[model samples]
Target: MYHVHLPKLEQMGLIEPSGNWYDIRRGPRFDEIEPLLRVIDDHRKKLPGDVL
Candidate 1:
């Protein structure tokens, strides 16, 4: 995930990696997906077990 997922998300402006490479923070575009994440969390129990 360090080489694949993290870089992909970073490229999309969804996550920002720390200078030391040991931490991460929300990127500028995080707001774009925040609503979707909230909806998913709100209905997580109703979703299929494997969906998450």
Candidate 2:
């Protein structure tokens, strides 16, 4: 589920924990998740640079 995936991302510091919100963590770029991110990028055409 989406909820389960988020905590895993947080644990990896790919995303940070805000006040009950998930703010993306610093550095470590989405290229780290190229296979997955690429699939997503293909669907969306673009991903917000602010997050990746």
- Candidate 2's C-alpha runs over 4 A off are 22-31, 34-52
Best by lDDT: 1
Task: Give lDDT tens digits, candidate 1, residues 1-44.
Answer: 24778888899999999884568999999999999999999999
User: What is the TM-score of candidate 2?
Assistant: 0.40
User: Residue 38 lDDT in model 2?
Assistant: 69
TM-score of every prediction relative to native:
0.80, 0.40
Q: Note the clash tally of each candidate.
A: 0, 0
lDDT of each: 0.90, 0.63
Q: Model 1, 11: alpha-carbon shift in Å? A: 0.4
